[model samples]
Target: MADYRLHTIFYILTSLLSLAVLHWTVHKVLLSISRSKFKKANNCQPIPKYPNKDPIFGYDYWHALNKAAESRTLLSWLREQYRLYGNTYYARLQTANVISTCDPENLKAMHSTKFKDFAIDSRRKFAFLPLLGAHSVLLANGAAWEHKRAMLKPSFSRSQYTNLPLFERHVGHLIEAVRVENTKKGQVDLAEFFLCLTVDITSELMYGTSIELLTNGNKDLVRDMTQSAEGGHARWLLVFLANIIGNSTFSKSVSKVRNFMKRFVDEAISYRQHSESRSISAKPTARNFEGQQGTEPLDVKGRVIYLQQLSLGTRDRKAILDELTTILFAGRDTTAALLTNLFFVLAHRSDIYDKLRAEISVLDGERPTFEQLKGFNYLQSCLNEALRLYPVIPINTRMAVVDTTLPVGGGPKGQSPIFVSAGTNIAFHVTALHRRKDLWGEDAEDFLPERWEKIQGQGAWMYQPFGGGPRNCPGQHLSLAEAAYTVLRIVQEFSMITGRDSEPWTELIALTCTNANGAKVTLTEA
Candidate 1:
């Protein structure tokens, strides 16, 4: 009797599931038919799609998934598609169709010209809410996003020169840590070390208090940040479970991070309030920019701390937390990825490395001041080239909020404007775009920094590693400055940077692009 009952229950469950699936299939077929008829009636051509050999699941998702899994990255597969399908192409991801483009005009139209017709993919933004917070500037829409951008603008303005000293202090810590590693373990995992460096720097800047992650072993938060960003099938499953039950391992972990962030912000706010209440004497002089050896008084005329800046911007604690986390997440991973790629390239090419060292040598063993760092055009070029090759955020996606037409790349001929449906998801392939020979030269795939010298500021739309338009990253100046300074300081302190991996490092897309394996390198003392 018990066995018969169990079998009956299983049969009923399976029948219901099968019916649900059939219903979904019928709905999808009807929707497709309607869309096809609509396009035909309007004389509109559809975007070209990669040949789907196995259409059982509605697309060749398994083939793309298998190939991407084998490569350990979706970027390699996307690049291959670009090679075969020209600048614009489409592929189905699960139930949704994703159109990808590397054409600069199309990219410009989507990002800037017709920005009103599209918005950040709501699904992607929702998935990130627990990590980035509900009020995050990166996730906000319309007026809220514009307001956040405007508020944060003054804080990151060019006049914020005092940040150079803060950068120097952190780089000093990074160099010290590297030196310790040089002695203790012949090679250091620079990937992890740079992450620690950025974490310490970002933490200190965000809250006016340093966690000193480089010196200490408390890297749980950093590890969690990376894990959250590198979430896979297991994480998604946990997320689904959490959503259903209101609690799961993923939710707990997210809560841990959120609580940690809230605590830090609360403490910082408390400290600022206490400091404001007390009568404080003015400090002596501006701290030396070289070593950051002295303490300068806060609330100085021309000086601003990020926390104070946020306080000025908004009184909402959640908003402050959102912006801080967003900035920290952005500032840390992207810069570290750039540094990792830069050193990885420098390790192999002695000629380029030599030229870079020569350029930095012009500073004559002295720490380059903010003004001095700017004049190293070659250093900037090298950074630019590295960004071109390995953009930290290789792929970005947007959803068409309203029906729109792309500038070009559509129809059988592939030169006409493509009609995008209201709900279509579009991806701007930065990696492929950067490598296009027509936009760049024939040596677009090559790592020649000299190319930047010729085309500097010429093709803004084409060369958008940091992205472009209203929603572009505002932290570029700070990121570039820190990277340049770190490179200069590393070269000054070390004679050579050689690593175990002789060939190009495989990319791992985490919070940003990172080495699939950690970047292991030995530093020879200068």
Candidate 2:
């Protein structure tokens, strides 16, 4: 009886193993047939492959990328790769196949033409989940993303950002900080000051109260937030190991930052409830550019507080917190990086500075209104030029949710359609695209604001400092206005600006890119 039972068990185990092998074989055959059909139907051609020493895993290419990132030359390295391997090429990163492109046509197709065909990769979303909640607009896709976008749109309306008085108060703090730094050190790192200024402004706009980093209030918050962001970036780089090995320091810092934000969320909600119970409206006051105290009015309504606007949308505290944190992160870093990069160039080029000052001089020392700031032709040109040279988010990636074909980046000349398999990652290099000689002329490498004057427009997909399509930055006008207003004010106060650092601009990339050496400059007081 024991021998019979052993024989039966052995027979069953063998049958199960055979079935598993047959299932795998059938799936592989079906996948191969489907991919063949897809390639033929789309007329897809093979993309240029990188000349990797380890062709199987592309370890050579991966190692080179790490070295470039460590030396702060990743952008230049990427540009060189594009030059050598056409506008787009394919490489294997470990087990995954990666496509890198600096082609505008491919970018347009991914970001706009076939937007729904792609989604932010799961690795990116996983890395950011700690800093921004799972439901963050930055991480969500499909219907969830649409819902978050709709909820946040009203808060970034024209009336909300055009509150010049609110911005002036923050800019005043920045000017004072710069003056103090100049007196103490004989030179100011405007890059640092710009970060502080944006933090203060963003906090005030999002939470209805400033953390006041400019005045040295809540320095720990800034430090913690920085640590958290760095930790998130590290996790994004090592996504495979991130789940297995946890960093306690990263967790603590993220918690601190979230807790700090939650306090504001709770307060906003509580205040809304109290006001409703008492049948009263809450009004916030701000000092005008002239330093006069007054209640700043917007469309005959009181000041538009982002927190208040969000409270009306939904009472779910976590949902509101996620949206607020996501916007705050984007708004603060983007504007700061823009100011740092633009000012770094301005400090070196006195001619450009004088031209900008001459344009701003039309205000005759008066503060600029929203309409006036938008109308400054030369100022707009300088901003455009800076963005072209140093895009804040230098490189971005999207994953193919379903099998799709890119408009270009295949065949010998890279003008043929390429079949992108589902689960493939496509990284689009914005810095390389902006600096392409073919798109922007031979002097694309140079920082000449005059280029904007000569060109009718940058042409579609050619100049996307704020990105393009449905997922394009909503705070585009806000950041531009803030940078423009701050620049005009600084130029008005200082008679001349001179670069203190002899070193050329090197990238200090985090969530955004800024000058590695900092924007060190001496400002001669007017």
On lDDT, the candidate that comes out on top is 2
Q: Which ten-residue region of model 2 has the weakest summed lDDT? A: 288-297
TM-score, candidate 2, is 0.92
lDDT of 2 by residue, 44-132 (tens): 99999888889787678877987888898999999999989989899876556789998889989998999999999876787889998
Report the lDDT tens digits of candidate 1 across residue range 1-526. 9999999999999999999999999999997898677666656666777776654453466456556845776777888888888789877664666788988988888878998888887656756777788778778877777666655565565655337777778788888988997789888877787888877876775556777777875678767767666642223223343355553544666666677778767765665576568854334332221222222334554544566655544447887787777877777888889998888888777788788788888778987888889889889999999999888888778999876678777777777777788888898889888888877879988899998778858368888787778888888887888788888888899888777775557878755777776667888898
Scored by CA lDDT, what does every candidate get?
A: 0.74, 0.83
Please list the residue runs of candidate 2 whose C-alpha ends up more than 4 Å from where it truly belongs after superposition.
Answer: 53-58, 242-249, 275-304
How far is 516's C-alpha from truth in model 2 (Å)? 1.4
What clash count goes with each model? Answer: 0, 0
Supply candidate 2's per-residue lDDT for 496: 96
Q: What is the TM-score of each candidate against the true structure?
A: 0.82, 0.92
The total of clashing pairs for model 1 equals 0
